[model samples]
Each structure stands twice: as structure tokens, then as C-alpha cells.
Target chain A: MAEGALTAELILGTTEDVLRRYGPAKATVVDVARALGVSHGSVYRHFPTKAALREAVARRWLERWHEGLADVAHTDAPAEQRLRDWLSTLFEIKRQKVREDPELFDTFATLMRENLAVVDDHVTGLENDLAKIIADGIESGDFAPRDSKVAARAVFDATNRFHDPIYAADWKAPTIDVAFSAVVSLVVSGLSVPD
Target chain B: MAEGALTAELILGTTEDVLRRYGPAKATVVDVARALGVSHGSVYRHFPTKAALREAVARRWLERWHEGLADVAHTDAPAEQRLRDWLSTLFEIKRQKVREDPELFDTFATLMRENLAVVDDHVTGLENDLAKIIADGIESGDFAPRDSKVAARAVFDATNRFHDPIYAADWKAPTIDVAFSAVVSLVVSGLSVPD
Candidate 1:
């Protein structure tokens, strides 16, 4: 079963690569199969149609992103540290993907915006987790009584906005890092207990 | 001379409309000249090439933006009120552009990013203006002593980030206003002088 899963993962990765290169309109099952050096029949065995293949690829990518989030969600790190790590992870992924192909970055951004409903559940879960950590900090007297939900949303939006340049492959990491640190520090200081 | 300047301005507006309808790659000088119901030779009299016409349209847009800033820079409004108006005007213009044509947004954003040197200078001027206001507030015992440069950058980035959805045509005014207030309150609360 493990070997089967690994094969499936590899096939999905290849499918996404083809999709990114050719766009959804031209990225057919046969195209993916050809790129993977596999028979069309073998591709059909895994994904019955092009739509199914695309759906599977998107789901796989979201699952991988969630898995990364899960890895850090419950770590023993302080709340601020966790938030920074999460923001950094997001930027790193975006930057690496942008470096791979600018068109792919645009495609991914458009897909995410157009299909927010598809990932709503995962986003909600992440938001809840973030809010809980923030609330914990407040309860422990480390943070002020700012609205955690609003704060979390601001952090999410600010970080995502900074990824625009990254998606366009025009980002300077140091400058972006400075912007990121400023945002994180400002928010944290705003929420910190009075001296 | 005034008549000539008015004709040039009209031609610029017509060209912007045409370029916005069809992007620079597929858009043509003939199309713009035709749209304006002017002779192709007339357009050639003003702009030698399609590239020159596109650049003029972009320059006009930037000029209008800077003019708005200059008009408000010497207003007698308090620092916070001036800051809010500046942000609002910036976003209102973006929202108007998105409403005019969604596709034009990508064109504008792309042009702005590609010309970051010019865009950065505009932002730096705004930041310097904001820093002075912040410094005045500090001296007047309304704000705390924080790194004005860093703090100004944070305010600029956060407010600009909030304008993303407006440019995308996915934001409501009330929601964005709430967000604007949140950032403003966060900054003032975080950096305000204690009584």
C-alpha cells in the first residue's frame, strides 16, 4: 500500500507539472501519461478522465499544504514563533514556486482565488488553530485582549499580499523579510501586555 | 498651446481606453486612432509607435495619481485624518479602475511592478510625509517614540495590502473601511503616548 501510494503521488506530481506547463485547456490525460512515460491505459487506470486527473492533482497539493501546516500547528514553540514559522513557510513555498515558473505562479493564484470554496474547510481549520494559539497567549498574560480572529485575518492578508512579487518572480527576499518582520513585530507588540 | 495640450490629453485618454480593452501585445496604434475617430496619421504625429503610445498612457495615469497626492499634501487636516484620506483616495482610484474593466487591472499591476523604480519613489515620498506626521504626533505627546521609518513602512505596506481586493474587484467599501480602521487603530494604540 505504501508503494502504491508513492506511485500515485509521483503520477499526480507529473500531472501537475504538465498542467502548469501547458495550462488546463491543453493538459490532457494522454499528455500527462506521455510525459510520465506511461501508457494512456495506465493513466486511465488511475484517473478515469482529464477532469479527474486535474481534480486529484489540486487535492493532492492542498493536502500537502495542510500537512505542512499540521506539522507546526501543535509544536511546543511560542505563539509568536509559530506564527512567524507559518508565515515563513508560506513565503518560501510561494517564492520557490515563482522561481519555477511565473506563469505557473499566476495560474496557481488565479486557481486559488477562483476556487476558494474548494479549500474553505482547510482554511477554516487553519484559522481556528491560529486563533486558539493567539487566545492561549492572551490567557497566559503574554498578549493583550485584541480580537484574535481579526488579528489572524490581518496577518494572513498581509503575508499573502507580500507574495505578489514572489509570484511575479520579482521579489527580493531580504526586503520581503524586512517587511515580514516589521508586520509580525508590529502585531505582536500591539498585542503584548503593557509594560 | 492650451488647445494643443487639451487635444493631447484627449488622445491620451483615448489611447488608455484602447490599450485597456486589448492589452499592449494585441492592441494597435490603428485601433486607438480608429477608436478616437482620428486619422492614423494624426496618432503617428503624436506617438511614433505603439510602445510610445502605451508609455504615454501609463505616464498620464501616474501623473494623475501624483497630482492627487500633491493636491492633498498641503491640506490642513490633522495627521491621522490626512493619512486616512490618502489611503482612501488611493483605494478609491483602484476600485474605480477595477470597476471600469477587470482585465485592465492586470495590465496596470504589471506595468506598475515592471516600473517599480518609479512606483517606489512615489511610495517613499508618501512614507516620508507619513513619518513627519508621526514625528509631529510624537512631539505633541500623541504618539510614542518608535522607529518612524520602520513604522511608516509598516503603515504604507498594510494600507497598500488592504487595497489588493479593491483592485481585484472583490472587496466591499465597508469591509475595507473596517480593515483600514483596524490598522490605524492598531498603529495608534501600539505607538500612542501613554497619558
Candidate 2:
């Protein structure tokens, strides 16, 4: 990486640490630069304002989420299996994030609310990933032809309970697995083509 | 009706009026009682605490939502058609609420956050209403037999975007009706028994 790119990467890392320590409201550009042992101007050169920095952190965090699900989408597994595993993996990733460091997860959730533009882009990115799998399924004759973009979103929204932060409280319940399975199976069966 | 029964009904109705006028935080039993020309103690006889009063109002608001869908559940239409109409009605009801008086809808959304117990009961109640239609489908052999309760919930969760408050911002989009139709058709197809 170029020298500037390295510094920008460093700024993003330190910003996460600063956010973890002081949270979004209290964390500042100065705090991030100080954590990096660099000048605030140096950080500003990379990210012009606190909002820009926060948006970058949020985008980075969400991109990491997509990273975890990408392999499931790319695997040689059948389309139905791949879609099921992709959703199950996504749900597990969100659940683990909440379980391991809920404070940080909660912080990011708050940041997500403010940075809807970032969230919107992240959502579209993941949905596009889903659309790719559906498009492949259509080509392989594993699924019926339909509007893949809209179909991908429908699949995501259908399984919202297993992954939506609002229902994170229910993730630990004994019945959640049952509910997840039902929705997954329903969607898969719904997508199957007649022989 | 007995005067006491009448009193509880009066308290509930007045509580809603006060909440709409003052929002959840500022509206109190005193305001509700004053609106009805009754003492706070009289209101307390029906609802012992502020939380209880708020719960009653929320329950009432949510029950009204169920009431709107109950007829669709009971209609002579086929199971698939009934489920489709039920979901469409719900989305319309939510859209109407959002468009007709967003302030009231937003107020209930906030109150819903604080009163998860009320929300839980309301969810279960609505899901049960859904389960009834699914059960009828199973009995009539129009649908496959499975766990009706769980299946009902999946159907409900799949179409959540049209009705969930978190996605309320998207409910007004021109494309929302298209999305709703897609998910509804998918779920209806998912629930169909193979010929």
C-alpha cells in the first residue's frame, strides 16, 4: 500500500479502538489521532471531518459483515443449499456479534441509525450478492425465472426475525431455531422449480 | 353494562385521546382523568399504575389492529387468498396509519419500544389469528400440515417490511406495493400443497 493508504488504514483502526473506548458521541477525531500517536491534522487529511470518519468506520464494519457471508454465496453448493447456508450464516454472524461484545454491537447499531446512507449501500451490496446466487439458480434451472433483485430482497426480509437487531432479544430463545428453520425451508421450497 | 365496566372503557378511551394529544411521556393518568372529569383515583381503580395504564392503551391500539384483520381470517375465501388479503389489508392499514396521522403512529412506535411485553402479547395474538387461518387450511386439506403456529409466524415475518415500524420509512415508497406482492405470492406458494 502507498504511504497515505497505510496512514488512512491506521486512522480507521485507531478510530474503531477510540469508538470502542469512548463510544460514538464522546469519541472525537482528536481522540483517534491521539490513539494513533499522530496529529489531528494528519487524521483530517485522511478523513476531513468526524462524520466522515464515523461513516468510514461504519462502512468498514458493515463490509466485514458482508465478508463473512460472501463465501456461502460463492460456494459450489447447490443454490437452495447456498441460500439457506448464506442466511443461516448471516444470522449466526449477527448473533455472535451481539453475544460477544454487545456494547460494541449496540454502539454500531446506533451509528447505523445515523449513517443510513452507509447502511443503504451495505444493504444493496449484500442483496446484490444474494441476487447473484438467485440469477445463477435461474440459469442452472434450479429455480424459476423471476425478478432476481426483488426476489433477493424478499428472501432477506422474510428472515428478518432471525437477524434483525430489533429482534435480537429473541435470538437466544429456544424457539428461534425452529422459527428460522421454518422460514428458511419455506423460502427454499417457494423458490424451487417444477421438474 | 355495569357502571364500573363503563368506567374502565371510559378510562381506556380517554387515555388514548390524552396520549394522542400529549404523546406518551407527557400524558399521565391525571391528564386522562381530567379529560374525563374524573379524579386520578377513579382512573387508578381501573389501572393501578401509569405503566398499567399505558399497557392498556397499547393493548387497545394493538387489538384494534387485529380487529381489522380478523374478518379476512374468517372470510369464506380460500386459505391462500385469505392469507393474501390478510397481508394486503395489514399493509394498507399500516400505510393508512402512517399517512393519515404519522404523529400517532410514531407515538405508538416509541411506546412499543418501552412496552415489549404488550408488544409480545400483541404479536402472539396476531400470530394466533394467522394460525387460525392456517389451521383451517390444514383441516380443509387446502394446505400441507405442519406446525401451524411456526408457519404462521414465518409468513408474518416474511412480509414484515410492509408493516414493521423499523421499515416504516420504506412503506411509502412507490415500489413498496410491488415488494409486498412478491413476498405475499412467495409465501402463498410456499404454503401450497403439491398437486
Candidate 3:
């Protein structure tokens, strides 16, 4: 990486650390710069404002989430299996985040809320990943032929209760796993081509 | 109605008005009592506590929601049409509440959150209503044989994004209606018995 790019990467790492330590509300550009043993001006050169820095950190976090699911989307398994695995993996990833470090998870959620454009882009990317799996199912004659992109959106919306942040509180319900299985089964059945 | 029962009804009506005017955070038993030209002690005799009064108001609101959905659940239409209409009616009712008077809707949401038991009962009642429709579909040989209660719960969870209060923001998206239709179609197809 170029020298400036390397510095920017270091700044983002320190910002993540500061956010983890002090939370979104208290974390500041000065804290990140101080942690890096650099001046606030240096941080400002890389990120125009505090919000920009926070948005970058949130984007980085979401990028990791996408990367985790990308493998499942491209696996060689049958399309139906891949789709189930993909949705389950996504739900597990989100649930684990909440379980392991809810404070940090909430921090990123707040940052993401402030960065609506970033969230929109991330959602669109996820839909595209789902579309790829649905397209494969259609090609394999397992799923009914339809617009994969549209199908992907419908599936994503339908499963929102399992993975959406607002529903995080209900994630711990004893029957949540069963509910997740039921929903995935219904979606798979819905996609199956009728005999 | 008996005199005490009448007084209790009056107290609840005044509580609703007070909650709507001041929002959940500021509304109090004294406010309700004052609005009804009764002493705070009189309100307490009916509700016992401010929380009790709030819970009653929230329960009343949810009761009305159930009443609205009860009609679609019992209609003479085909099971499939009734299911679709029931789900759509729920989405429309919730969306209208949010759109027509967002402040009051939010107030009720706050009250509902504070009263978890009331929320749970309300959810169970909705799921039962859905189960009735699913049971009818099964009886008519339109839907595959399965536990109607389980299928109802699954359908309810699958369509959470459409009616859940937390997703109120997305309800306004231009494509939301199309998305609702797609989900409902997928659900209906999922329930259909194969040859």
C-alpha cells in the first residue's frame, strides 16, 4: 500500500479500538489520534470528520460480514442446501456478534444507522449474493423459474426477524432455532418446482 | 355495566387521551384522573398503579387490532384468499396506525414494551387467529396436513418485516407493496399440497 493508504488503515484500526473501549457516543477523533500517537489533524487528513471515520469503521465491519457469507453463496453444494446454509450462516454470524460483545455490536449498529448510504449499499450487496444462489437453483431446475433478483429480495425480507438487529432481543428465545428452521423450510418449499 | 366497571372504563378512556397528548414518558395517573374529573385515588382504585393503567390502554389498543383481524379469519372466502387478506389487513392496519398518527402509535409501542405480558398475550392471540385460517385451509384440502399452529407461527415470523413496529420505516418504501405480495405468494405456495 501507499504510505498514505497504510496510515489510513492504521487510523481505522485505532478508531475501532477506541470505539470498543468508549462506545460510539464517547469515542472521538481525538481519542483515535491520541491512541495512534499522532495529531488530530493527521486523522482529519484521512477522514474529513468524525462521522466519516465512524462510517468507515462501520463499513469495514459490514464488509467482513459480507465476506463471511460469500463463501456459502459460492459453494458447490446443491442450490437448496446452499440457500439454507447461507441464511443460517448469516443468522449465526449476527447472533454471535450480539452474544459475544453486544456493546460493540450496538456501537456499529448506531454508526450504521447514521450512515444510511453505507447500509443501503450493504443490503443491495447481500441481495445480490442471495440472487446468485436463487439463480443457480433456477438453472438446476430445482426452483421455479423466476426473476432471481426479485426472489432474493423477497427471501431476505421474509427472514428479517431472524437476522434484523431490532429483533435481536427475541433471538434468545428457546424456540428461535425451531422457528428459524420452519421459516427456511417454508422458503425452500416455496421455491421448489411443483411436480 | 356496574358502577365500578363504568368508572374503570372512564379511567381507561381518559388514560388514552392523556397518553396521546403527552406521550408515554410524561403521561401519569394524575393526568388521567384530572382529565376525568376524578381524584388520583379514584384512578388508582380502577388501575391500582400508573403502569396498570398504561397496560390497560395498551391492551385495549391491541384488542382492537385483534378485532380488526378477526373478521378476515372467519370470512367465507376460500382459505387461501382469507389468509392473504388476513395478512394484508394486518399490514395495512399497522401501517395506517403509523401513518395516520405516528405519535400515538409510538406511544402505544412504548406502553406495549413496558407491558411484556400484554404484548405476549396479544401475539398469541394473533397467532391463534392465523392458525384458524391455516386449519381451514387444511380442512378444505388446499393446504398440506401439518400442525396449523406451527404453520401459523412460521408464517407470522416470516412476514415480521411487513407488520413489526420496528420495521415501520420500511413500510413507506415504494416497492413495499410489491414485496408484500411476493412474500404472501411464496407463503401460499409453500402451504399448497403437491400432487
Best by TM-score: 3
Superposition error at A74 for model 3 (Å):
1.1
lDDT digits (tens) for residues A21-52 of candidate 1: 88866677788778877777787877777666
- Pitting candidate 1 against candidate 2, the one with the higher TM-score is 2
Model 1 residue B132 CA deviation in Å: 3.7
lDDT for each candidate structure: 0.66, 0.82, 0.86
Tens digits of per-residue lDDT, candidate 2, B1-195, equal: 233554777888888889899988799888987888777887887789999888887888887865768888888988878888888888888888888888899888887887899888877877987899999888888777488988888887777788787788888888887778778877877887866
What DockQ does candidate 3 have relative to the true complex? 0.77
Q: What is the TM-score of chain B in candidate 1?
A: 0.70
Candidate 2 is graded, for docking, as medium
Q: After superposition, how far is residue B80 of candidate 3 from its true place, in Å?
A: 0.7
Runs of candidate 1 with Cα error greater than 4 angstroms are A1-11, A20-25, A34-49, A96-114, A119-122, A163-168, B1-7, B20-25, B34-45, B65-78, B100-118, B165-167, B172-180, B190-195
Go through the candidates in order and give each one's DockQ. 0.40, 0.67, 0.77
Model with the higher DockQ, candidate 1 or 2: 2
Cα lDDT tens digits, model 2, A1-195, are 233554777888888999999987899998987777767888888899999989999999888765768878888988888998889898999999988998898888878988999987877877887898998898889887488888888787777787777777778889888878888888887777855
Query: Residue-wise lDDT of candidate 3 within A56-126, one digit each (tens)?
Result: 98899999865769889999999999999999999999999999988888887888888999988998988
Give the distance in Å from residue B48's predicted Cα in candidate 1 to where it truly belongs: 4.5
Interface RMSD of 1: 2.3
Clashing residue pair totals per candidate (backbone < 3 A):
0, 0, 0
